[model samples]
Target chain A: MTPATPRRRGRPSRTESADTPAARDRILAAAREEFSERGYDKTSVRGIAKAAGVDSALVHHYFGTKEQVFEAAITLSFAPAMEAPRTVEEGPLDGVGERLTRFIFGVWENPATRKPLLAIVRSAVNNEAAAAVFRRIIVTQVLRRIADRLDVPDAELRAELAAAQLVGIAMLRYVIKVEPLASADPEQIIKRVAPVVQAHLTGPGL
Target chain B: MTPATPRRRGRPSRTESADTPAARDRILAAAREEFSERGYDKTSVRGIAKAAGVDSALVHHYFGTKEQVFEAAITLSFAPAMEAPRTVEEGPLDGVGERLTRFIFGVWENPATRKPLLAIVRSAVNNEAAAAVFRRIIVTQVLRRIADRLDVPDAELRAELAAAQLVGIAMLRYVIKVEPLASADPEQIIKRVAPVVQAHLTGPGL
Candidate 1:
C-alpha cells in the first residue's frame, strides 16, 4: 500500500491487516531503513510508521517503543550471528575458540549479513541509545551464554574479553576497512585471531 | 574577527595573521568541532572556515583539504596516544605487550583524551573518507612503527592483530559502553588484555 493511503479510524483487531505477518515485516524493514539512514537519535516512531504506510498506533501496538523497534530490527539483523551461543554449546571447550571465531567470521564473510551488521555498528558507535540497545542484546544473547557455559574464574570478564577481540577485528577489517587486516585472507585472520580468543576464554592468568 | 569580515584586499604574506599559530590553531579547533558535530560526510571546509571566522581559503592554505584538516585534527587529538610506538621500543620484547597496553589504556583512561577519541571513532565508523584518513594516520604513525620493531613473520598482520584487540575493547568500553566490560576496573582489564596483546605481537603459531 502507498504511504498516502489513510489508516482506518478504528484499531484493528489481531486478525486485521495491521497484525498480519506481511505487515509486520513491512514495518520492520522500514524501521531498519530509517535506523540505517537517519540513525537512532533522529528516527522517530511516527516516521517509521509513515514509511511503512501504517498508523503510529500500529507501530506502538506491535513494537511498544522506538527502542523496542530498534531491538527487534537488530535482533533480526543479528539472527545469523545469534547462533553463536549455540555454537559454543556444540563444541568442546578446548575448540570453542575456533568454533566461535569461525562462526562469527563466517557470518561476517557473507556480504548479505555484513551489510546490516555494518548498519548496526554505525548506529551503535554514534548514539548512546543505540549502543545501549546493542549492548543489551549482545551481552544478554551472546556473551552471557558463552560465559555461563564456561566454568572458570572471571567467566563473565573472560567471555567479554573474547568478544572484544572479535569485535575489534570486525571494526578494523569490516567497518574501518584497515589494510592487511581488511584484505587479508579470511582463513589467515581466523588462524591468527582464534588463538588470542582461545587464550582469553580458557588460558590461565598471565 | 567575525565571519562578516571581508577578506583583506589580497593574500596576506607568510608573516600575517593567517599564517600565525593562533589562527592555525583556531582553524583546527573549529575543524574538530565541526567534524565531531556534523561528521565527515556532512562537514565542509567552508563551514569550518565560517566557524573559525576565517575565509575558506585560509583553511586550505593552512591544511590543504577537508581530509587534510581531519588528519591534522585527529593527529592533534591522538597526540597522547601517539607515544604508543615509542612505548613499544622502550621495553624488552617480552614486556612490550604490558607496556603498550598500559600506555594505550593510560591515554584512554583520561577524559580529556577520551572525548576527542570518541569523536574520531564516531566519524571514522560513519564515513569512508574519515575512515581512510584515520587508517592512514594510524597505520603510518602507530601500527607501522610497532610492526617495524617486531622482527616476526607477517609482522604487519601481527601488529594489526594486536591493534585490533585494543581497538575492540575501546569501542566496547568507551563508545558502546557495554556493561561489565564498561564498568570493570581499568587495571583489571589491562591485566587480562595485555597478555593477549603480547601473544598477538610475539607469540608463536596457534
Candidate 2:
C-alpha cells in the first residue's frame, strides 16, 4: 500500500501563503504612522488595513482590536525596573546613580526604542484611553517594580519622585523638542543627571 | 437741551445694569470649569458664555477670543523666573539650587497659583494653539530669564533641564494623578527632588 501525501489544511504554509513577518511588520508600521500622524481618535482599522495592503479581517486576526493593535504597535520591550534592579544589585551602590542614568539615556538614545516611546507620549497626552494605558504601564511595570526594590522608608514617594525626574527629561528633550536639550550630548547629560537620579533612588533625605 | 441729562455713554454702566463682580466672578469661574472639563478644543465661546450665564458677545467684550478668555482666566501675575532669580541672587552661587527649588515649590504649593497652572497644562496638552501660547510664555517669561542669569557655559541647556525637572514633577503630581506621587507630601518631595534640580542648574559636571 502506498502512503498518501498529507493534505495541507486551513491557511496555506508560508511557501504557499502570502502572510509573512514582513506583512505583520508592514501592518504595525502603518498603524504607528497613522496613529502618530492623525491621533488615536481619527485613525481607523480600515485605513491601517488598506495602508498595509491587507483585508480588515487580517488585521483583526493578527491584533484583536484597534486598541490592541495600538498596543502592539507601541509595545516597549525594555523593562527598566527589571534591568534597573539588576544594575542596582551589582557593583558599588555608590555608582548605582551613574548606572541608572546611563541606562535611561541609552534607552532614549536608541532609535528603535525612542520612536515608539515618543508615539506613546504624544498619544497619551492627546487621548484619554491611551493615557489610561500609559498610566497603567508606568504604574504596574515601571513604578511598582522600582518602588518594591527601594529600601527607603518612603519607598512609594521615592519611586514617584524618580519616575517624575526620568519622565520629565523624556518630555522636555523628546516630546517638546526644546533646543540644546533636544541636541545635548548624551554622555554629558548622563554624567550630570545620574547623581540626581541616584539621590532620588538611594540618596539620604528623610 | 439739558446736557442730555448727563447721559452715560459707551457701554451702559454695569452698576446700573445687572452686571456685578459676583456675575463676572461667576462667569470666570464657569469658564475655568468648562475649560478644565472639556479642554480648549471641545469648548466653545457660546458654551463658555452659557456656563457663565452671560451673552457670548459679553464674553467677547470682556475677553476677545476663547484664547484671550483662557489667558485672562489663567494668567499668573507672579513670574517664576522674575522672582526666582531675585531669590537665588541673594544666596551664594552654590546655594542657587536651594533658593530656586524653594521659589518653585512656593509657586506650585499655593492653591491660588496651582489651579491656574493646572488649567494651562490641561489646555496646552489638548490644543495646539494653547500649547504654542504655553511654549511662548515659558520661553519668554521663564526660560529666557533663567538662561540669562546662568553663568555656566551651557546656560541654556541648564535652564531647560531645570525647567523640564520642575514641570515634570508638577505634571505627575498634579496633572497625571499618579499615586503616592499625586498625594505625596510636598516638603518631602522638595527635599528629595530639589537637589537634582539644583544639580541640573549649577552642578559641577556642566
Worst 10 residues of 2 chain A by lDDT: A1-10
Count backbone overlaps in model 1: 0
Q: Which stretches of candidate 1 lie over 4 Å from their true place?
A: A1-17, B1-19
Question: Could you give candidate 1's per-residue lDDT for residues B72-147 as a string of tens digits?
Answer: 9999987887889999998899999999999999889899988888889988987778889998988898988999
Best by TM-score: 1
Every model's DockQ: 0.48, 0.23
lDDT of 2 by residue, B117-206 (tens): 665665675466776666666766667677777776788788887777787888777666688877777777777766776788777654
Predictions in order: lDDT: 0.85, 0.69
CA shift at B67, candidate 1, in angstroms? 1.5
lDDT of 2 at B24: 64
**Candidate 2 structure, TM-score to reference:** 0.67
TM-score value, chain A, candidate 2: 0.74
- Give residue B87's error in model 1 in angstroms: 0.6
